[model samples]
Target: MATNILVTGASGFVGKNLSTFLQNKECKTNALSLRNENWKADFLKSVDAIIHLAGKAHDISNVSDSDEYYKINRDLTIELFNGFLNSDIKKFFYFSSVKAVADSVEGILTEDEVANPVTHYGKSKIEAERYILSQNLPEGKKVYIIRPCMIHGPGNKGNLNLLYKIVEKGLPWPLASFHNQRSFLGIDNLNYLIYEMLIKNDLQSGVYNFADDKALSTNELISTVNKALGKKAKLWKVSKGLIEKTAGLGDKLKLPLNSERLKKLTESYVVSNQKIKSALGIEKLPLSAEEGLIKTIKSFKKEK
Candidate 1:
C-alpha cells in the first residue's frame, strides 16, 4: 500500500516541490489549501502523514500587518496540529524558519539555544512551535518541527535571484569585503530529509535545524554565480567602513542599499545541521552547498 500524505499550502514554493518529490516516491499525495473552507474535511480523510507548509512568510518590505503573521503562522498551525492529533496520521511535519530562533545568529545556530525572536513573523513561528511541543503525542505518532535557513532552489525568486541578476548583468559585487558566512538549504536536500523521516519510523520526533553541510560567504556566492554564468567574477573589495557609512546614509535617504538590506546581503547566519545528520546517521547530505547553488544559478540563466 502507498503511503498517503496530505500537504497544506500546496501552492507555495516548498509545498510544490515537496508534493512533486513525494509523488515521484510513489506516495499518494493530496494538496489542501487553507483558503478552502472544506479543508478540514479533506484533512480528516485517510492520510498517513501531514506536511504543514502553509504560513505567512516574513515580509522584508515591512508593509504586512503584525496580526497577519500570528493569524496564519501561529493560529493556523495550532488548528492543523489539533487536527493531526485527532486524525489517523502517524507523522506530522511543520516547516518553520531559522528566524524563529534569532534574526541575527552571532555564531552557528543550534537547536539547543534559547529562542529570542524579534520580528512578529519569528514570534508567531516560535509560538506555534511551543504550542506543538506542549501537546501530548499518542503512541505510534511523531511530530517534527523543522527549522530551515534561507531555502533556495531552481524556481525560487528570493534574495538569491537578486544576486544572480546582478552577476548576470556583469555588475561588480561591492560587499566582497564584508566576509561573512551564511547557511542555505537546498530544496532537494530538504525533500530528502523529509522523505527519510517519513520512511524511518525509529527517528525521534522533535525540533531539527536543517541546512547544508558547508557554509559559504557572500563573496563565495558571487563567484559561484559567475562560475554558473561562465563569466569572470568581478568582486570589488571596497573598504567595509565606507560601505557601512554609505548604508547608514541610504537608510536616511531611502536608497536601495539601506542598512537592513546590506545586513541581509552580507551578514553571517551559519546554521548547524549536525543534529539532523546524527539523527539520520549520515555524515553529509546528498547535495553539497556549491553544487546546489550552481544548479539554482543555472536554472536562473535558463529563464533568460
Candidate 2:
C-alpha cells in the first residue's frame, strides 16, 4: 500500500517540491495549512507520516514581530508532535534550520555542536527541537529533526536570486576579492533523503545536518552562474577594505550593501553533511555541489 503522508506548509518552496516528489513515488499526500482552524483534525486522519515545514522565516529587516516565531515555529510544532505521539503515524519529519545552532559558523558546522542560537527565529527552532527530543517516543515511531542550510532549487528566491540578477544584467561582481565558501542544499537531494527515510525502517531517529557534498566559493558560484548563462564571468578584484567602508556607509544611508548584508555575502559557512550521509549509508549525495547550483542558475535564466 502507498504510504499516506501529511505535509504542512505545502505551498512553500521546500514543501511544494517535496510533496510533488513524494506523489511521483506513489505516496498519498495531504497538505495541512495552519490557516485552517481544524488543521489538527486533518492531521489526525489516516496519515502514515508527517512532514512539518510551516514556520515564519527569518526576517533580515528585523521588522517581524518576535512573538509570531514562537507561536508558529515553537508552539505549533509542540502541538503537532504531541499529536504524533498519540497517533498511529510511524514517521515524522520536522524541517529545522542550521540557524538553530549558530548564526555565524566559525568553521564547518556539524550535528555535534552545542546549540546557542542568537536570533528569535533560531531560538524558536531550538525550543521546538528540545520539546520533540524530551518526549518519550513509543516504539516503532521515528522522528527526524533535519537542519538544512540554504536550500536552493527551481523556484527558490533569496540571496541566490539577488546574485543572479547582478550577473544577468551584465554587471561586474565587485566582491570577488572577498573569498568565502558556503554550504548549500539541493532540493532534489533533500527530497530523495526524505523518501529513503520514509521507506527504511532501520535508520535512527535524531537530528541530521543536510547539505550538498561539496562547498563552493562565491567566485566559483559566479562562474557557475555564468557558465549556465553561456556568458564569461565578470568579476572585479576590488579592495576588501574599500568594500567594508562602503558597507559601513550603506548602513548609515540605508542602502542595500550594509555590513550585515556584506557579511552574508562574503562570510564562509561550511556545513558538514557526513552525519546524514553516514545515516543513509551512502558515500555521496545524488548531485555534486556545482551540478546542483548550475541547475538552480539555469532555472533563474529560464525565468528571465
TM-score of each: 0.97, 0.96
- Alpha-carbon lDDT, every model: 0.91, 0.91
lDDT of 1 by residue, 74-153 (tens): 99899999988998888999999999999999989999989999999999999999999999999988999999999999
Clashing pairs in 1: none
lDDT of 2 by residue, 90-196 (tens): 88999999999999998899999999999999999999999999998999899999999999999795779888888889999999999899999999999988888
Stretches of candidate 1 above 4 Å error?
A: none
lDDT for model 2: 0.91
Model 2 TM-score (2 dp)? 0.96
Q: After superposition, how far is residue 185 of candidate 1 from its true place, in Å?
A: 0.7
Error of 2 at 225 (Å): 0.9
Q: List the residue pairs that clash in candidate 2.
A: none
C-alpha positional error of residue 49 in candidate 2 after TM-score superposition, expressed in Å: 0.9
Rate residue 250 of model 2 by lDDT. 100
